[model samples]
Each structure stands twice: as C-alpha cells, then as structure tokens.
Target: MRRQPSMLYLRPFMPLIVGLSLGFTLCLVCLPLLEEGCTSEGSVDQVARLRKPNSVQETQDNPKPAKSGGKQPFRARYISTELGIREKLVVGVITSRETLDTVAVALNKTLAHYIHKLLYFTGTRNVKAPGGMYVVTHGDDRPVWEIAQTIRYINDHFHKDYDWTYLVTDNTYVQGERVTDIFDHISMNRDVYMGKRVPFRDMDGYYCKVGITEKDGTQAFSQACILPLCRGEDVCLFVCLFVTMETILDLQPDEWLGRCLHDVMGISCVGEAEGVDYHTYEFSSTTDPDNEDSQEFQKAHTVHPVVEPTDLYRLHRRFAHIELDLLYPPIQTLNPCFPAQIKNLSHKTPEGEAGLTWPIGINPPFKPQSRFDVLSWDYFTETHLYTCPDGAPKCELQGVDRQDVDDIITTSVQRLNDKYQKQGLTFEHVRLLNGYRRFDPTRGMEYELDLLVGETGPDNIRDVVTKRVKLLRPLSQVEIIPMPYVTETTRLYVILPVTVHDREQVAKFLDSYAQVVLDIHENSALTVVFIYDPLDAQNIQEEDVFGMLKSMITYYERKYPNAKIPWISIKTDVPTQLKIMDIISKKHPVDALFLLVTVTDELTIEFLNRCRMNTIAGWQAFFPIHFAQYSPELIYDTKPYPATVEFGKEFGHFDVHAFDEACFYNSDYMSTRTELQKQRKENEDVSETYNLYEMFLKHSNLHVFRAVEPDLRQRYMPRTCNPHLSEDLYHSCLVSQAEGLASKEQLAKLIFEHDNEIKSQAENVVKS
Candidate 1:
C-alpha cells in the first residue's frame, strides 16, 4: 500500500519542491552578480541606481569636525536646485467665461514664468486650453465659492505636496521673483495668506448680513447685519479660505484682499507680521502714469485691478529681471526726475515788425489800476451809440470800417458754430451782433462781437466761445447770451454786503472782485447784485463809498462791455434788506442766489468755471458751495511757508464750515429764504447770517460741490473779515497773495534742488 501511494499522490508536493529548488539555484547564480554590484531590471537595486545623486552628498565617509563656535550646516532637503522659493508656490487663478481669455494672457505674460504649477479654474469649458496652461472646469460661475472649491479639488486630486497656494482674480498681476523674495523667510508648512485687507464696518451698508455661526450656538453675524460687512468679490475669496480651511492669512490693509477680508469678516489685518510682507498694490484706476516708476511699484509682489493687456505687459517687462535691489531701491534715497517747467510767456510783437502804438494827442482812456481809484464814467451808457445796423438795441458794432466789422462778426459766428459742433454741441439757431465800447484808434479801431445762441438745454457753449474768441481776437472780447428760445440758463444773482470798512481795508479784494465779473461773463449767463450795507460805514462816507463803487462798476463795464452789472444800496436793517432782495428777485427770475457776507472774498475763476460746467452738465436743485478760510498771516507771508502748515487752522482747522460768504441758494432754496427770514425774526436767539444756510440745509435735500481746490490757498480768502472789515484786513489780503506767489517760487527751488541731487546720485551710480 505505501508503494502505490508514493508514485501518483506526490504530484502536488513535487511542483512545490521544484519551485523551491529553482529559487535556491537562482540565488546561488545571482550571488556572484550581486557581489559585482550588478542589478536586475524591476528590482529595488535598479531603482536606487537610477536616482540622481543627493544635492548635499558627503565627499568622504566620515563627517568633518565643525570649527569652534561655527554655525551648523542646514540639514533641510532641497526640493529644487534651480528654483528655490518658486518651487514651493502653486498659483490658482479664479476666472469665469467673461475673463478667462484675458486672465490666461495676463498669467502667461507675468506669473507663468516662475510658478511651479499654475491652474486656472473657470465656470465653463468654452475656452480652449493654451499650450502649457492647466485649465480646470468648475460648475459654479461665482468667483467667491469657486475659489474655495478649486483649492479643495486641487488638494484632493493632486497628490503632490505644495507649500503655498495663491488664489487671485483674473485682474491680479504678480511679480513672481518679488513674490518668491517676499516668502523666502516664511515657512512652507504654515497656513499663510497674503493680500489687501479692508474693515467690515467701512464697507457700504448693504452687505451687513453675511456671517458664520460660532460653535457656541450664537451667530458671529446675523443675516440682517451682513450687508455692511460684506465686501466685493475681489475681497470675498480671501475670507472664504478661513471659513473652508482654517487658514491664517497675512492681510495688507492697503491691498484689495485686506479690504475684503476686514470688510466682510470683521477681521483686522496686520500691517506687518511673520511670514508676510505687506507689499501688494491695489493700483487706483486714476493712478498717475509716473507712479509706475515709483519704488513701491517696483517692490510690489502683487498688483490688483490690472485687467488691461498692455498693463500686464508693462509689469512683466519691468519685473522680469532678478536684480531686486537695483530695481526697487528705497524711494527716500532715489531722487525723482522732476518735470521741466514750461514758461508761458505773454504774446509779443516780433523784432523789427511794426506794431500798433497809441496815436499822439489821443488819450488812452481812464483805466483803474487799483480798486480804490474811481474812474470818471457811468454804469449805463446810451444805446444809440452802440446799436446794431438792424436797429436791435442789444446788438452793437464798434469799428471805423463798417464792412470790416460786419465781416469779422460773420467769421466769428461761423467759427463759434464750428467750435460748438466740435465740442459735441448742437445749436438750434445762432445770431451774431457787434459791440462797441470806447474804441482805440491805434488798435485798428477796436470792436467786439456778441453771440446769441439758442439751444434745447443749458450747456457749456459759453465757455467754449469765450476761450476761442480770445484766440481769434486777442485785442477784442466776445459775449455769449443763451436766449429764451433756447434752454433756460440758471442765473446766479450774487448779493454782496459791503461795509465802509470793507471799502478801505480790503481794497485788493475789491480789485479781485473784478475777476469774478470776468469769470461770470466768460462762463455763464449770470448777474451780480451787490447789496451795500451802510451800517458799518465808518472808514468812508456812505455817499462817497457808493460813488466809488459805481465808478468801479463803470470802469469794468467799459472794459468788459458784454458783462451785465446790476447793483443796489441797502440799509443794515434785515427787513429792508429782505425787501430789496425780493424786489430784485421779482425783476429778474434768478435760478439761484448767493449772499456774500464776506464782501472782501473773491470767487475764483476756477470756482466760477466749475459752477458753470456743473450747471450745464446737470445741476441739482439745492446745491451748496463747500469753501475754506485761510489765516491772513499765513497767506501774506513773504517767506516760503511749509506745506505742512495746515490751512484753515484759524477756523478750527476745518476745510468746510458754516460760512455765509460761501453759501449758494438754488431756485428752490431761494424761495425758502422768506420763510427762513421769518424763522430768524421769530427766534431772535438764532444768528441771522449763520442760520440762513443752516435752515435751508436742514429743511431740504442738498447737493453740495467743493468750489475751491485745497491746493490753491489764495482761493480760500474770504472777501470780508469776521467782524466787518477787521484792522488786519489789508495786511492779510496782501500777505496771502504774496504767500501764494512765494509758495510757487519755493516749489520751483525745491524741484531744482531735487534735480541737482538726482544728477549727483546718477553720477555716483555710474561711477560705482
């Protein structure tokens, strides 16, 4: 029985024995090969042999002893030999169908050079993948949620470890080398986020409801309170990271990310922190072209709101180099190249050319050099002396040659029509008339033209005409009157309260007032209604003051014949003043009224021009002028004053305040003046002058505009002093003008100094 079982039953064990025998034989045969360092295919030895040498391999078997007090060698693994910090960065750009192509071009031009791995997540698969671009399709179109989902998807699908993940919008432009440098000291394992930060409370009130429920069962922010907190999409993505992944973000308050993070999440960003340098730029839409050359721009790691392709290209060209120190030197040490000053010289007769000269024995006429000088003339002139040939009283022609005057008028009308057309304005009809003041025989018989334009609405056509007319006839002047058949021009009737002290103390201001008339004449169809207050007429007799003022008006009228001048005398009595204003308003249906309490203060040409432009563009019903008041000592200083010397400091350092001299009353507001006066009379405790503007502001909706530019300190001077005309009025007026001029001179000097410094620096840099 044992013999019969051995032959056939041992078949399974025989195969196992053969396999063991074969393995034993193979090991014996490979022993010699293993000793010789020969490795077989698909073996662990083969894999080890194929791998490149370690970057920090020991040259000898034994380690070298360290010198006493010497620093220890870093044992950290090198991820890449060529790309240090860049090797760890993985940038993910969030874009949509609308901006996918634009973002692709921008990334390909800028960040694509240094990024270890670049991914673009878009809403749809409508885009064709570019040559080296990794595009991922997402179901969501919203950038806020999509950014979060994209990061999560990358982390899940991609098994490779990435030290940093940068999430940015399509408009974000990154300087890759700058970014690497910024994050060089930062640990890769830390949950670091970098971007601009904004406060939640500073955002618009509508986004105050968005918030998360804390673990304590109370909502961090209720639904109703999210509106004011919620920020723009540019900011929301940064906040999403903290919600989705417990990320510690380094927020820059100056950047879009910080603005969004703080605005939406009530998070305060640090100006400086570990692992982050706040060097991001949220470039303003109105950024000056010169800002691109600034050190801040050179050092910027990321610049946001850069949607334009040209801007992306420019940034790329600027930051492509590796010379960080040379490119981004400290601004304090670097001298900026100042722009060359272009001197605007007045027109002059060419050398050896015959010019017009005053005829012998012909008086040049009485020209008032000072406000105190009274010209012997009348405000109202005879109509027959300057009437048009067509018998229209409003039309006047002044020239020795009638045909030549007619030809000039015709040319001016045509030119005006063309000018209006070029400015995108259309006129229903235009009529030209000739004007004659006292003619200068030597100046080829002086003449002027008046244009009557009919349009559908109020427009800045008058401004255009005034500018062009001056070019056409530098010796003459042109007036533009918007007719009733055209759109109604809003008339600003200015009421100036002039005291006798004002006449003596602020004579320079009176001279400056003539400029206001010129501004109104050139820019708008308006009138000035000066109301002289005789109560404080102590410096000069009331009659003499009135006569002097009349003379001044007559002088300006003759000089600017097209200008309309209407004025009346009023007692200091408020009731009497109100009656006179009412009468004036009835006679001329004014669209607005201004009460100039500070009669010495002059309305600048810039302010008047702005008012005209705003009105033409579409003015509000109740518009107020925001003005400033400057100190007399500061204004009149002959020595250069520092820019740091705060303006309007004497008036509580406020740029705007309750200044009656700065108030403007619209048509609706002018109607309420009677009620305001009544209220003032009933409540004697209220200041009549101060309460007038305040009452209108409180009762009605106001649309205010800053009439004066803060940079122009001369414009801030009030026409009259606080207590009528103060004793220091003249000193202040003169000093302020001198200070303005001195400031300009000082600025020029500073520019020259800086230019010299820049030249020296350039020479040093070259020598080095």
Candidate 2:
C-alpha cells in the first residue's frame, strides 16, 4: 500500500464510477429527444426527468454502505429486506348465527378491509341471513361441521387466493395492523400457518382426567382416513390444513389451537423449541383495555377470547395508529442480533428422544409439610364442669386452659379500661367469678364474672356483682347444636265452635292438633277453648259436648306427660262469643290467638317453632295464613288462588282475601276486635262480615310477618265456604259434614312428606 494502491484495493470504487457513467448515458439518450421537442427552458425539464428516474431506481434497488466503506453481503442484504416487508394479506372470519349478532358485527366494523369474506353457518333455514355475507346451512350444531364447511367454502369461492385463514370464535379480538406486522417476517408463499400452541402431554392429561377415553384406556379420537381426527373442533381443523402444509407456526402454547395441534394432531409446535419474532397474547375475559398493563399490551400481536363487544371496539382504537417502526428500536442504535435459546423445552437424549428428566435445581411451587400451624388451644379438665340449662352435663368441653382463659379475660378488661380511660373514666375491681360455666344450647359457652365499677378504685366504693360473659371463639371453629326444647316465652289461644253435626269431627281435629301443641314443651303454653251453641246444646246435650272437649285435653295430657295442658269449654252464641273471648283474654293473656273454624289441616313443627321465635323477636301483630283447597286429594288437580284476597272480597272470588279461620292475631290485637265488631255492625253496607275484620287490622298499621309455608298449606285444607250451607251454622258444620277426613295413617304420611321439605328449606336459608 505504501508503494501504490493496487487494482484490488480500488475495486470497490468501480461500481460508483459505473453508476455515474450509466446516468450520463441515460442523459445522452434523452438529449436528442429533448432538443427536437423543446426550447431552452423545456430542455432543462427533460434532462431533470432522465436523472430523477435513474437515481430513484438505484436507491430502491441498493443498500447504502457503512461509514467504514464495507457493504453488506448480497445474500444477507436480500434476506433482510425480504423479511422487513410483506405483501397485503387476505383474512377470512368464521362465525355462526348465534354469535353473528354480537361478535360478527364487531369484526365487520374493525377489520373490513382485511376481510375477504365473513362466513356464517346456521342450522335454521328461515334466519333471513344478512346480505354481503356468505351463509351456509347444515343441520348440525357442532363447531367442527361449521369449521370444515367454512374451509371448503373459502377454497371454492376465493380460488385459494387468500394468504391466511384466521379461524376464531365470535368472542376473539384481533388487530388488523398488528396481524399484518406479525406476518412481515413470515413467507406467505411457503406452506405456513401461525396460531397458539398447546402441548400434547397437557391435552392428554385433561382428556384422561375427564374420562374421555377408549376401550384400550387411551385418549379417543374419530377416524379420518389414515390419520385419527382429534376431539377438539379447533384442533381438528388446523390439523387438516397442516396435513396439506409444510410449516405450522404455533403462537401461544397455552391456548386451544396450539394445545390441540400438539395433543391431538401429534404436531410439534415451532416456538416451543425456538424463538419467534411475532408475539402471541390471550386477554382474560375480565381484562379491560382502558386499564391494561402497558408492557403486556406492547408485546402482543393478537389478543384472544375477548367476548365482550365493547372491548373489541376499544382494542381497535388502541392500535389503529400504531406503525411498524414504533414496534422496533431505531436501526442506528440497534445491537448485533443473536438467535435466542429455546424456552420450556423437554430434555432430549443424544439420539434425539425426549427424556423423562427435567433440568436440575428446579423447585416446586410450595414446600411439602405434614402438619400446619392453626389457632389451637389446650383444653383443661375444669371445662367439663359446665352444665346445660336443664342441669344436664354438656357432652363435650371445647375450652382453653385456666392460664389462657385468664390471659383472654385480662386482655379484654385491659382493652375496655384503656378505652374508658381516654374518656376520663376507669373501672375499680375486676375479678373472675366462682369459675362457674354454663352451656346455652343456642348461644354456646358462657362464663359468670364478678366486677365492681367506681371512681374510688377498689376501696369499698362499690359491691362486686355477677354478670354473664359469652365465651368468644372464631365463628369457623364453633359447632352449633339444635336446642332440645324451645326456651322462649310463647303462648297461643285457639278458639273454636263445636256443634251437634260436627261434635265428633271437632273432637278428632282437637286430638290431632293437640299433638303439635304438646311438642312445644316448657318453652310455650297453649290454651284450647271450645265454644258451643246453647241451641245445639239442647239437642246434643251440654254434658256430651263438654265431655268431648275434655277428652281432647285428657288425650294430650296422657300422650305428653311432661307437658302442661290447659283447656276449657264454654257455651255461647254468635253475639256472646266476643264476651266469652273478653273473659278468657283477662284470665290468661296469650302471645297470639288462633280462631279455628275447621281442623282439616296439619301443623308442622317448624311452623310452631317459627311462631315462638317470631314472638321472641318482638313480632306482635299479623302472621300470614296460607290457604288450600277444602279437599286434600283435589289440591293437585285444582288450581289455587294466585294472591291474597283484597278488601271486601269473598274467598276464591278475586284471588285475594283473608284466611279468616286460619289467621293468627296478636293477643292485644284480638282484644281490640270487640270495638271492630261494633264498628262493622254500625256500617249500613254490611254485605260481608268476615273480611271487614281484616280491613280493620290493616288500618291499624300492625306488622305482618309472612309465614306462608307451601307444605303446610297442602295439609291444612281451606274452611268450607259453600253458599248452599246455612249461614247461621258454624263454619265447622260444613267441615264436619264434608267427606274424606284424613285417617291417622294419612296424617302420618303428611308429616313424613313435610320432613324433607323443611330440611331443604333450612339448608337454603343457611347457604343464602
């Protein structure tokens, strides 16, 4: 080089010299044409045109050299240029009638230009399928049939001109520009398909676990020529196309298409063993693009399973302005490129067979342990000293030791003291009582405490008093037990009228009803009163009526020896019935009063329990009375009134009326009924006597608890309201004369039927 530059050293400059000479020759060729057709001004325009074409063509065909005067090799430059640009591709969308209204509409607006055709399949022939879309009818509901038909339709209609066929559900979301950018590195002329990839092992595990297997205990598939067809519709579709193609690009391994190809079609996806230029994404059903993760959004080419129509529109607006240059770094700042190593691939033997072992030093998600630390306490022997309200020893002791109990009590007291101290108040002496513990069936464990509160501290300022403190525990750790008997104060008075024709029927009704009354035990008291017509007493004999009523009390007393029975019988007419009611009200006030016109219905234990619990909860007014047909056997065959009767309407007439006979009134409410009856008689338009009483109660603003039990209604038949019967006769007269009184066996069967109904109802309440 020091001596002189050789020919080889100057060779690189020859191409520039040759390019300049070519440009000069092009100008020379145009000089004759320019001179013959132009003046001096026009000749400059002709020369400019000749230089511009040559310069532009050369710039487009060649790559600029680096500052070091070295140009990229010819083959490398050609490959890089080809990878950077791609021809416009045609895309086809497959949808169905079910999704056409939601997903198809979104696709039409978002990817209209890219869409070659929108193919919709439906089973119905009269759908009046939309115009400008291809519609296919095949009576099958399976997705496989629709997919297969769509492929055939595209091939036949488009003449194999499409670059890519994106098979997607109506719910999938895609960006047309992003999809185009992903294909830039891909060669469309080659046999290539890109989608999410799924592994074979994962798919096989899911199918085997779900019991989708064959007689040989392996995953099952339908027969399709020599190759077995996969169960998944998407898997089958891509595989069918793969059989005719060379290279299949699996985009996402976790998604359906990739899973199917690997598991069902026995295809090894590309990305699992190599790095890919394009990115695959799956947006969760719960994701919203307005608050999406920025890093995740930037990496994705296609986001799948976006079923929401609003999200599809939003996704389109986000990437509509994104240019391909923004997605990659600037060329001047770019580092030398290197191929990435394969990720998450299984180990292979020297012979290329997949090995059973994974990479060393890998850890499981969690550490294995035999036992876990839970909040537990040590039980003491003294815990067994507690007794139930009945003085019966509790079966089990779920309590902590003395030290722990003392610590809990001390901590609780300290917290209370600290809170009051902030308000310039403090407790004096605090002491645990004789260590007495009691078990409340409903409230769980409790302890008796003795404490003194005064400003003088503990210096003879106050006396120590006892108080009950509920033993506290986590609700999850508590076990609840049903109380053996009701404990709340509940009283019910049943008023009934007995007549000559129905004296025996009334006795039977009282007999069965008393069984439910006795079940209430010491928690509640019941008084049953029988009213007899003085006129009917003359024919039936008063002693006989009294004897029948007394017999009912004797039967219940003997049956429930432990329960207290209180009952009385009085002789009265309609006018004097209210007077008798007043006398009984003063003698033994009740929580509720029930007027029984007929005793054809059975009462459930649950209803009786609810009555007691409601009373305890301060419900003192109306309790809902459900109605049923007069005949039990006809209940299912005949329809019931849809609603409670409105004011002044007869039963079964307007589908809304009071259940006069079955209604329960607060004892205080019943006491005010004498004045209501007086008001009713004073009104000039007294077409109906029964419903007027209900209207009076409604105006009083009394609280009404809806205790309508459908099961109870079936057993409790409605009072006979036949207009054919004499109005003067007691309502029970019709019931007594009515045939088909349920025998003891039938009554037992009714109780059994209600048992399951109540249990299921309780479970639903607890769950809710």
RMSD to the true structure for each prediction, in A, is 34.7, 31.0
Q: How high is the lDDT of residue 75 in model 1? A: 59
Whole-model lDDT per candidate:
0.48, 0.46
| Residue-by-residue lDDT tens digits, candidate 1, 664-740 | 44454455665565655565533324333444555444444434344323334433323432234334434444433
Q: Identify the runs in model 1 with alpha carbons over 4 angstroms from their true place.
A: 1-491, 505-521, 525-543, 573-584, 590-598, 612-655, 662-666, 674-690, 701-768
**Lowest summed lDDT over 10 consecutive residues: which window, candidate 2?**
209-218
Best-fitting candidate, scored by lDDT = 1
Q: Give Cα distance to truth, residue 644, candidate 1, Å.
A: 19
Tens digits of per-residue lDDT, candidate 2, 269-320, equal 3431123444555567667675475676766666666666778887875665
The TM-score values for the models, in the order shown, are: 0.26, 0.26
